[model samples]
Every structure is written in C-alpha cells, then in structure tokens.
Target chain A: MKHAAPTRTLLALYTAMVAFVLIAPTVVVIPLSFTDKASLTFPPSGWSTRWYENFFNDPAWTAAFGNSLTVALIVTVVATAAGTAAAVGVSKWSRKRMAKAAQMFLLAPIVVPSIILAIGVYAIFLRLQLLGTLPGFVLAHSVLAVPFVLVSVSAALAGFDDRLTTAAASLGADRWTTFRRVMLPLILPGVVSGALFAFVTSFDEVVLSIFIKSPYLETLPVKMYASVTRDTDPTIAAAATMIMLLTTVIIAVGLLSMRRKKIA
Target chain B: MPDKTPGAGTRIDVKNVTKRYAKSTAVDDVSLSIEPGEFITLLGPSGSGKTTTLNLIAGFTELTHGSIEIDGQRVDHVPAHKRGLGVVFQHYALFPHMTVAENIAFPLQQRKTPKAAQAALVASVLQTVGLAGYQDRFPKELSGGQQQRVAFARAMVFNPRALLMDEPLGALDKNLREKLQLEIKRIHQDVGRTFVFVTHDQEEALILSDRIAIFNNGRIEQVGTSADLYERPASLFVARFMGESTVFKAQVSSNGSDWHMDFHGSTLHGPVTSTVPGKGALVLRPEQLRVAESRADAPAGSAAVPVQVIQNIYLGSGHKYELRLPDGSTGIVRTPLTERTSLRPGDSAYVHWPAHQGVLLEDNDLVSTT
Candidate 1:
C-alpha cells in the first residue's frame, strides 16, 4: 500500500496537522506556566518559575490538590473491584441477551450526556442533604469512572479461556480458590489499566463535580474552574501542567507493565 | 470400599444414565459398568454422547435420569471438585501463567498438602510422565506433546480415585498421536487405575482400550473387547463403525439348521448363530475376503460374488483390491503377500469368503441418525 510521492506528502501533512491541533493546547500550557508574566499569555516575553511557586504555596490550591488525589485513589479502588466483578459475572452469564443488557447498562454512563447526569445527581444529592460532602463527590465521580474499569477488565476477560476454570475445578479447587489462584493472575493486566483509567476519570471530572461540590470540599478541577473566572493568573496553567504530567506518567507505567506481562 | 488403598482404582457404575437438553437428548439410557483397574474407551463419532457420558461420570455434567456410583456409593449430588477424579482435556488446559511445576502442584496445594510433600509429589509425577527437569518452563514454552504430558502429570499428582480423559491426544499430529498412545497405555498399566477415555478414532480405541463401548445416537449399541467388536458386532451400525466391511443387503431366511440369504441372484448359507429374520446384511471384514481369478478357483462351499477388480493397492504385508460387485456397489478384498493372486484392474474375478467368517447382523444401520 505504498502511495505516490505527492499523495504520501499530502498524507504526512494531514497527519501532522491533526497531531498539532490535538497537542497544541497542552504544549502551550506548559510554556505559559513558566512565564514571568502574571497573566497566562502564550509565547511569553520572559521566563520564570513564580507560577509554579504560587501553585505549590497557595493553601486553596494545595487543599484542592490533596482532595483530588484522595478522591481519585479511593474511586480507583472502589471502581476497580466493582467493575472487575461485574465483568467476570457478565462473561459467565449463560443467557447472552441478559448479559448484553447488563453490559449496556454498565456502559450507559459513558454514552449519556454529562450534563444530564450532573443535573440528575444534583437533584438527588439535594434531597439526600448531601450536596456539600466528600461522599457526594466520590459517589458522582465513581459513577463516571466505573465504565472505564468495566470496559478494560471485560476486554481482558475476553482473551481468557473459560476452560481454565473448569480445569481448576477438576483439580479440586473450589470457586473462590480458582478465582484467586487462576483467574485473577491472568486478568491482572486489565484490572491495573482499569484502575488507572478510574483514577484519571475522577481526577479530571468537573461537570459532575460542579453540580455536587461545596465550599469546604472542592476538587482540583472544580477549583480550577473557579480560578479561571475569578482571576487571570499563570498558576492555573501550572496546575493544568501538573495534572497532565501525572496522568501521562500513570498511563505510561500501566502500558509498560502490560507489555512486560505480555513478553513474559 | 471406603477403606480402599490410596492410589488404587475405584469401580464406576453408570446405571441407565440419560442427559437431555431442551431440544435433544445427548445421552439416552446409557448404562455401563467400568471395573477397577480396567482401561475402557467410549468410542463414537462427534455428538454421539461418548464425551457427554465421560462428563457425566466426571460430575461436570448433571444426569437427567438414573445415577452414577463410585465404589458402590451414589455420587449424583457431588460437585466436580469433590468427586476427586482426574480429567485431561483434549486441548491440555494447562494454566498458561504458571510454570509446569506450579501447575502440577496446584491440586496438591488445594488438598492442603504440606509444602515439602507438594514439591516431592510434583517432582515424582513429572518424572513419571517423563518430563523431568522441565519444571521451570511455562506451558507456552513447551511443545504440544510436552504440554499434554504436563497436563497428564497435573491430573495424576493428586492420586485421584480414577482418571478420565477426553481425546487427550487429538491435538497432535498422527505420528505424535501414535507415540503418545503407547505412553498413555504404559502409564495406565503403571497406575492400575480405572481410566475412562473418549475418542472417535476406532483404531486408537482398539489399540488402547481393554474394552470398548460403542455409542450410537446417544445409546450404547454394544460394549465388548476389541476382538468382540471387530469379529462379532451385534448390529450393522457396529459392524460398519468398527472397521471396513463389505455389506450384502439381503432377505434373511432361516431353516432349522442354518441361515440363508439371497445376494443378487445367488443364495448364500451361514450358520444359524442368531434368528435374524427379514432384512439383514452379511458383513465380512476386508481380510476375510479374497479375490480369486474365477468362480472355479474359490474355496469349496464358500460364498462367492462375481466382481471386476477396479484397483489393486499393494500394502506392505498384503494386497488390497477395490472390487465392483454385480449390483454396482463397491467391495474390498485383502489378501496376504504370500497369497498374492493374478488379479489386476479390469480383470474378472470372484470375491470369496468362508461362510462361517461372514457375520449375519440385523439391517438396522438407520438406528443412528447421525
């Protein structure tokens, strides 16, 4: 499928344009965070690390950062456990139509508009008197994060042989022992990736968090949204850069570990 | 029975076992008693309930009717893991993530065997399967035959009451399959445990089994030793399934002393071994048939049919001839190299067999829908 010279040139140009468009915003934010200017202006006239200093020193930013990390970590654990169980159960269901319906239900959060879910959660949280609470934010973010876990774990289970479980049982292993000894070690790669996805989903959530956040409990994304409207500073760019770096490192680690497992 | 020696075999009794799905019956009223220390094979084509019967006995499948007993104790309520039977699947379902040593040690660990004893048992069983010093390798690293041997070692390490195998050698090439068949037979002899093997290859079944049970249409058509199945099949389906046969569909008429059948226009006489009336077939094995140059050269008092030699295949120890009978149906005749005849393609000859060598079986080939 080699292309003509002119066609190959055109294809390379198109690919480069798409890549620049996708990466420009993130790339620009990194440089803007190092600017000496107080405002977030691209191609800054001077360079400094004052914004990074402000991002680390400010109590509001620090609290929001800590809150975000805690929620993301907790959501990762909860969502990974629930989603892996759901995936295994759905894979073993003998009634295919019912299994398909259950899968669609688990994935509905990813397909439905975020605003609709935000409004629905806000109304329910208001009635429960949980509008300004940590549990409220954790609950909403977990609802959005679980689908990522489910998809990754289900993909892993798809390649797993169902006969291995039968083989385990014939060798005198009970259901729990078979799962812990045979099934888990095989599907661990999927579970790890799902946990990382869950962490990023909760860490970056804003729309649902905006509906549920309180003055006392604001995640990093919610605080960033408030900052952009109330102030014009390069500190927000520093925060964005940090978030990008954290997720990229997490994803890279996940991919490397999965690749190593495959090689082994 | 409860005090039977460990590592010794246990008798399995399946009484009128039937497994019925919603649409069709997989195993229908199949009853067989397997003796301890006997190697029995469930021989049938695909979907003929041989594997299903093995699964039923393994407790992986539930029997819809009747019961199964191990050592005279009913086990219909037992789970697969609790039944303590070793099972080797066709694909050698070894745990891919585990090393060979760990895979074989899994059953011992499940039984709460001590750590030191588990290692000793795993090593001993691996050596028994002739896979010593290959313990650290993963299943994917081993060849297909090696993986199957590892599977065999894993299934046997726990000293189960009996061993059940479902076409364990089916995934290998013909040469490896034959080689492993001998290894499996030797292992069976060394263990002296009851083995219930399932296979569709009749030659493999005959080579390995102490007794073979022929399954057809979810029923046990016949159960006998290899010689009993090959020489004296109870029905036409058994005769056709066991080996190659030359069949003559005829109307069976019996006198007080002998049985007679009309083949084309000639009358053939056989001993009245069974009172098979009406439609029947005179089935003779290929070796039982010989090709003579003419009717005058056929043996005295032998039933002979005029045929044209279509092709004569030279076997190493004998010659096999493809024959065209008078009714256009093909027949086969095998003669030893010592008795090589002048028969060649396009030559007129008579395919003859001793009257006593022909088995007069009921014409019930249609009994098996598959």
Candidate 2:
C-alpha cells in the first residue's frame, strides 16, 4: 500500500490544502477578535483583548450568551433521552421495514429545509402563545438536535450484541434492570457523543433561531446576526471565536470517548 | 469442598410443547420428561428443533401449543427472567464489561444476596469451573476456553435448580472441548443439579449425558441412554445419526423362524424383530462388521456381503477397511490390530457381522430427504 514518493508528496499537499480551506475562517476570526481597533480587520496593526472585555461587559451580549447556553443544555438533555429511546425501540422492532420507516421519519427534521421547519414551528408557537418563550426555543432546538442524537446512538446500538441482553435476562435481570445494568453502560459512549452533538446543533442554529427570536430573548447566534447588520465591531468576531472553541472541544471530547470505546 | 448432601434437582416436563412460526414449525409436538438430577442432552443437527426445545424450557420462546412444567408447576406463561433457569450459550455470552467476579456475582446481586455471601459464592463457583484466581480479569482478557469457564461459573453461581447449556463447548478446539466436557461432568456430579444440554456433536452427548434425546426435523427421533440409541435405535434416522453405520436398502420377509433381508442380489438372515416389515434397511456399525478373506472364512451363522477393499487405514489402536459394496454404496469395517486380517487395498473380501448385531429398521423417505 506504500505510495510512490511523488504521489505521497502530492497527497500531503492536497490534504494540507483541504485543511487550510476548512480552517481559514476560524484562523481569521481568532486573530480578528484580538484586534485593537473596534472594527474587524484580520492581521491587525496592533493586538488587544478589548473585544473580549466588551463581550463580557455588555448585558445584551452576556444575556444572549446565557440564553444560548440554557437552551442548548435543555435541548441536549431532552433530545438525547428521546432519541436514545427511539433508537433502542427501533432496534428492537421485529418488523424491520416498519423500523426503517420510523427511523426515516425521525430523521425527517434533518433532511427537510430548516426555513420550512422554522415557519411551521413559528405558526404553531404563535397559536399556543409560546412565541419568543424559553419553552418554544427549547422545543424548536430539540427538534433540530434529536436527529443528531439518534444517528450517534443508533451507530452505538448497531455494535451492541443482542445476545448480551438475552444473557442478562437469563441471569435474572428484568427488562429495566437489564437496560440499566448492561445496555446503558455498554452504549454510554454513544449517548455521550449524542449529547455533545445535540448541544452543538442547538448552539450553532441560526436560521430557526432568527425566525423565532424576540428582542428580549435572543440567542448568541441571533445576536451575532443582528450585530452584523447594525455594526462592524470585532466583538462579533470574539463571540464567533468562542463558539468555535466550545464546539471544537465538545466534538473532540465526543471523538475521544468513541475511540476509547473502540479500544475497549 | 465440603461433603454436602446433593441438592434435589427440579423436574422439568415438556408436555407436547410445540412452537410454530408463521411458515414453519420450529418445534413440533415434542414432549420430554426430565428426571431430577439427570444429565439429559438434546442432540441434533442445526435447524432440528433441539435448540428450540432448549429455548422453550428456558422460557425464551413462547410455546404455540401444550405446556411446560417445572417441579410440577406450569411455567409456560412465565418469562425467562422469572423461570430461574441458568442458560449457557454456545458463544459464551459473558459480559465483556464486567470482571470475572462481577460477572459471576450478577445473578446473586439480582437476588439481593448479601455482599460478603456474593463474593464467597462467586469464588466457589469460579473454583468449580477451575478459574478461581482470575477474579478481576475481564472476559476479553481471557482465551475462548477460559471465557467459557467464566460463563459456566456465572451461570451456576446462583444455584439455579436446573442448568441449560446449548453447545457450551462448541466454540473451543477439540482438545479444549474434551477437557471442558470432563470438567462439566464433574461439576454436574458435585452440584447434583439437573442439566439439559444441547449439542449437534453426538460424541460430546455420549460422553456427558446420562440420557440423550435425538432430534430431527422438529421432532424427537429417539430418547435413550447412549448404549440404547447405539445398540437399539428405533428408526433408520436414529441409527445413522448416532454413529457411523453401513446401511443396505433391503426387502424384508419372514420364513416362520428367522427374518431374511434380500440386500441387492444376496440374502442375509437375522432373527425376527419387527413383524410389520416390508422394505427395511439393514444397519451395521463399523465395529460390528469384520473383513474376511472369503465367505467360508466368515464366522459361522453370520450374515456376509461380498465387497472389495478400497483402502486400509491404520488407526494406531485398530485397522479400518474402506469397502465398496455390490450396490455401489461404501461400507466401513473397524477391527482391532490384534484381529487385523491380511487384507490389502484392491483385494476382494467378505464383510460379515453376527446376524443378531445387524439392526433391521423400516426404510422410508424420512431417512433420505433430510
């Protein structure tokens, strides 16, 4: 499988080009966030942490950050529990065609256009008087995040041996006990990765958040969108940098847990 | 080990239990009454209802008809977890996440046994399976044989009344399988619990089971001690399944004294055993047949068939002759080295056996199709 020297060099160069394309935006934002000038200008003449201070000092920005965290956390919990249960149920379904249909239905939110989903949710929330409410945000974000959880959890369950469940039952474990003692612990890596995915999905969501947001209850992404139109402050870049850092850490943690499970 | 009195095992009665799927019957009206403290093996090939019957007793599969009773109480409606039966699977379904001690202690913990007592029981069961000092090792850390020993320890740790094993030694090499077979037999003797085992390997069944039930096509062909099945098989299927046999399709008739079998073009005589005989199969075990130089050299009053020696195999302890019969079927004959005749390959010979030893069974398509 060893490549020729020229081919190896070409492959390394191609990989580096792809990596640069993916990382170029994050590199620009990180440096732009530390610019001394109020305006976002990458490769700045002077460097400072003024935008970072501004991000922490302004109540609007801080409130939006807090709101995003709250919504993402709630969405992670709700979506992970619901999605994990759905995955387990689908896996245990005797009729495979029905199970596949159910799975495709659960995954429909991911495939359907976000704007279409946002408009539908907004209409439902307005009638229920839940528009711009925390519950409304949570419900909408959970809908977007659940499919991520389902995909990860299903991947984990795919590797699980059904005979272990049978073995647990034969060892005097009831259904719930078997789940708690054997199935849960075995599939915990998948659940953890799914939770991480749910958090990132909710945090990074913008199109749905924009449609549903009230001025008083804006998420960080909504605030950043609004800020981009009204001003050119580097503070938006700071927020973007932090979001990148948070998601990168979460994804890295998810991958590490998955790798550990593989090694075990 | 303390010299404790053997615990009285539970009796399991499978009363005409049948399990039918949408298109086929997995287990046809099969009934077996297992005595307390008995080591009974359900022996058959794959797809033959033996494993289904084991699952029925384990309460894993619901019976479509009839009922199962354990200790005289009907348990057909009970779930597997509540049936209190230990099952050892063919692949050794030990929990990879748990240590040896933790795996063995799982059932004890389910029963809410005291922590100290659970540890003692795990240790004792591990010792019983000969894995005493490997408490903290995970299943994947052990070899297949060692993992199966751990599985056995886990299944028996809770002292279930009866243990069900479905080819527990099937995943091991032949040497390890034989070793574990002896270990399981000794464990059964020490614990005195009823054992219901399932295996396609007839030799393993013969070595370990006090009684063996032969299954074919979702039915129990015969249930008997190994000797009973070997010496007196009830059907052609049972006779062929139990051991290596040379079968001759024959026409059976009685002469008011002895039964005669017209095999191919030769007449072979035996005692009258079955009265309703028309077409029959004469089955002769390898050890029962001897290769002689000629018809006159065959033992007196023995039935003989003319055959050509195709190959002579030296088996260290005995000599085996591959024979080509007149009907284009192959026959085998095994003789002790002390009784080895000066027979060579390509030599014409007479394969002879005592008339009483040749079992004449009813011939039917049931034996040929499967």
Candidate 3:
C-alpha cells in the first residue's frame, strides 16, 4: 500500500508501541500462572497446573474469593435497585432544575475523589459498628456503583416519553401502577448494565476494601495483594489471571446485553 | 339539548383560573364554561394558553387564582387521576409494557372493579376504538395510528365526566390527521359527551368546534361559531385570523341618511353604521368581491376599483388574483376557476363589493401594520 509519510510513520510507530506496551506483560504472565516453580520468574524451567490447583485447593484463597463474590452481589443488588429508582424519580422531574441537582448528586460518587469517599465510609462504618463487616464494604461499594447505574438508566430514561404517564393517569391507573407497568420495562436493560457495573466495581476494588476490612475478612484483591507484598509467588499470578477472566466476562456480558436492547 | 332540562347543562365551569411559573405566566386569568354535550375548541397560536386551559380542566396543573367546577362541584383541588376526565395527548403515549387489552383494563382495575367486568369493559372500549382483533398485541408492535386508537380506548374506558384533547392529531400526517378528525367527531356524536379540545389550527377548530374560543396572549380574543367569526369578526386580529381578506382605507361621509365612503377619488355608498360617521376603512373578504359589468346609477356598487391584474394563482378549487391598485398597498382578489374567461396578467378590471359584504372598522391604519 502506498502511504503518506506521516500516516505511514504514525501507523508503524503505533503498532509497534501497542504490541510492546499491551502484549508484552500479558505474554509474560499467562504462562507464569501455570508455572511448576514457586517463584514468579518468567521463562520457567517447568510447566504444570500446581498454582491453579493450590489457589482452588487452599481454604484461605477460596474463602477470600467467596467473600468477594458475596460483597459484589450485595452491592450490585442494592446499587441497581436504589439507582434505578432514583433514575425514575429524576425522569419524572426531568425538565425541572431540582432534577438536575439530584442527577449531579447521584453521579458525585464518580466525580469526587475515591479517597474522600473511602475516608467518609470508614468513619461512618466505625460509628455504625459495621467496621470490618461485609455489609459495610458492600454498602460502600454500592455507593460507588450507583453513579454507573444512574448514568446507564438515565441514558435510557432520556428517550422515555413523559406523556406516557399522563396517558396512564388519565386512564384508571395510579402513579405506582404506571411506574411498574410502563417505566420499569423500558428501563430494565439500562438497569441490568448498571447492576453488572456494580458487580464488577466491588468484585475488583482494591481501595476502601484495603483500608476497612480486617485480615480475616480479606477480599480476593486484598488477599492477593497481601500475598504479593509478603512474597512473590506463582499463586498470586494465578489469582490475578482468574480475577481478570471474571471481570472480562462481566464487562463483555454487560456490553452485549445493552447492545441487544438497542437493536430490539 | 342540555338547556331544555334543569341541572343538565354546564358540565364544566372554569372561573378565572391562572397558573404562573417563576417569571413566566403560562396561563392567566382564563375563564370558560363548557355546556353539556358541547364541543368547545380553544384555538390560538403556540403559547397562547389554550393547552393550559385544557390542563386546568383536566386537573393537571393547580390553579393559582380561581376554581374549576365540574357539574357545579368544585374540582380545583382534585388530582389528575381523580378528576374523572378522559384525556388524549398529542403523542399516543401508549404504555410500552402493556398489551392493548392490559392498557385498556388499567383504569377499570384502578377503580377496583370485578375482573370479569373489567375484561368486558376493556373489550368494549377496544371495539369502540376499532381495535377489535389487536387486544393481545403490545403498543410497540402497532403502527402510530393503531397506537392512537389504543390511547383512545384507554382514555374512554372509565366513562369520564368530560373529555379533554390537547392537539390529539398534531403528530399524524395530514391524511391521517383529517381521518382521525372525522373519527373523533363521530365518537363525540355517538357518546354526546362534553369535549373541550385545544388546538391552534383554525380550520380544525372551525370543523370540529360547536363554538370556538379564540385566544391571544393569555386571554380569549373572541368566542363564537365558525360562521360568526368568518362572516362578522369583532376585531382586526379576529377578522384577519379567521380567513383571507382584502381591506382598504376609506374616508366616509353621510349623504341623506346613507353613509358613503370616498375610494379611488370617487364616492361609494354602502352599509350604514350606527358608530362614528367621519372616516374609517372597509374590510372585504376575497370571496365576497365580484366583477359586475354594470356600475351605473346603482349607488350601492359605486366607486368600482379600476385595477390591473398582476398575476392569477390557480388553486385547485378556485383562482386567487394578485391585483395592484393605483396606490402601492397590495391586496388579493379571489375568483372561482369557472369564471376566468378574460382575467389574466395586465387585464383591466373593476373590483367592487356589495354593501353588506364590507365590514366597517376605524381608520387606525397605523396599528394594523401587520
């Protein structure tokens, strides 16, 4: 292909740079997850599933994974419900200035620095006697997930016709019935995507969980982090590989579901 | 018919209602009383407050200044769902989740009606809206026109005390709009329910309204029948708004109990008015002007305006003549297609009106610039 000088140079430079930056680390790590040796050294002298077996076989690793799953699920449920409800309330009051303020408040979880939220959550959880408890972590994560839910559901609610509720009200239906029968179904796809985001956020979170939870109630990220800090091993690499796999699947599913809704 | 029996008339009485939103007055001091079985259309341009009037009657907005009485009982504080007034919006606004049957059954369900009776009512209302076989279909599966029928069914299912339509046909294409207009008229006739419709389209208002309330700026400019507004408009706005007309300045003088207007350097005697006698202008509808061969001793058709035909526009039904007089003030003369025997560009002709055809207005021509 004949190429202009700048375009050809940029394309070549971007391709090589992307390959070095993205593929290099991933290529070095995947094989390490299956290393027979205990050390995290690349170009391993042997190959086996010993690290994977150990990660699944050890009660501590499995328990931490289970705890992470539980926290993510609870956060997803609470965030999706509260965030979708907020979306509907704001949609009905869409054109008003107050609705705009409520929307900004909902998205403040994303806009404000995570450190501030972590500090606030830590302080509140301590007073509530919920420090180091699973509920406290889940609630804090759900607050982080709400902005995602609000954004997704708010996008869906943008195209919602306000007159639909008026039409329902003019008929025999009350406000609650109108929301249940009319608004919920239309906004379900966005809510599901938001819920998936909630799941992913809490599942993969490294901060807040690091500060708030105890050593006994360590999430998968905290456990893997603690293991890496104390010593470098192929087991930590194995856990990292699994977490990446789970997150990739969740993100892919959320994107596909949203796309399917749009097409339909 | 309602006037013939006591306690039957005056289905809706709106007494000096007003709605104000910070720094903007949406509806102001509006008052209208709709008789039972009457079709009163509030007609005006956008933001003229007709839609606000309908919303007030439907209990959509809280009235700031006045009370709304339905059947002589105050409904000013009633919530929209409890007002018991059926409403059809501009958009079809069909519930996306529900099937046609479910949407229609909603109102019945809200009232705690029995299940079997609710089904029967939903079926009957669907039939009334001409959606008999589409009961199981969801709103998204139907066309725009079908969705509108479902909206109609949903609105009328509860047998509301009155009906309010806010430009219900505003979204449809022209053919569908005209078709639905007829269907709405038929439904109104069959039900004989008082319908207060709000629309800015004057032709739609004229065709559907028993009497129209023409609104402007936040108040009712005039309220009259279609013929009344077309034939004898009260003000310049009403006269010009109702239909096409060609108006001219005339200096009038009284001659032997007959008022004559001086036009084109000639005296033309026409209808005598009880108002001021000095000077004013005469307004003529384009259709009311005629070309007469004889303008002799008959003082009624005096001062025939000698004009050169500039252009003739052929409307499908008739011919519209763009004629220029000696003065530069432009006006149009409408003639039927069958009578275009000698009329064309650059033809000499005299345009005159019968005495009764002209309506006299004060010669305040400066205020009539638009």
Q: TM-scores across all candidates?
A: 0.94, 0.94, 0.84
lDDT of 2 by residue, A16-81 (tens): 999999989778999899999978776888999999999999999999999999999999999999
Q: lDDT by residue for model 1 over A176-223, one digit each (tens)?
A: 999999999999999999999999999999999988999999999999
Q: Each model: TM-score of chain B? A: 0.95, 0.94, 0.86
Report DockQ per prediction, comma-separated.
0.78, 0.74, 0.55
Q: Could you tell me which 10 consecutive residues in candidate 2 chain A have the lowest summed lDDT?
A: A253-262
Docking class for candidate 3: medium
Interface RMSD for candidate number 3? 1.4
Give per-residue CA lDDT, model 2, range B283-353, as digits (tens). 88999989889999998888888999999999999998999998878898899998878889899999988
Tell me how candidate 3 scores on lDDT. Answer: 0.80
Off by over 4 Å in 3: A1-20, A23-30, A43-53, A88-105, A111-113, B1-10, B112-115, B138-141, B249-281, B286-288, B293-350, B353-357, B361-370
As for DockQ, the candidate ahead, 1 or 3, is 1
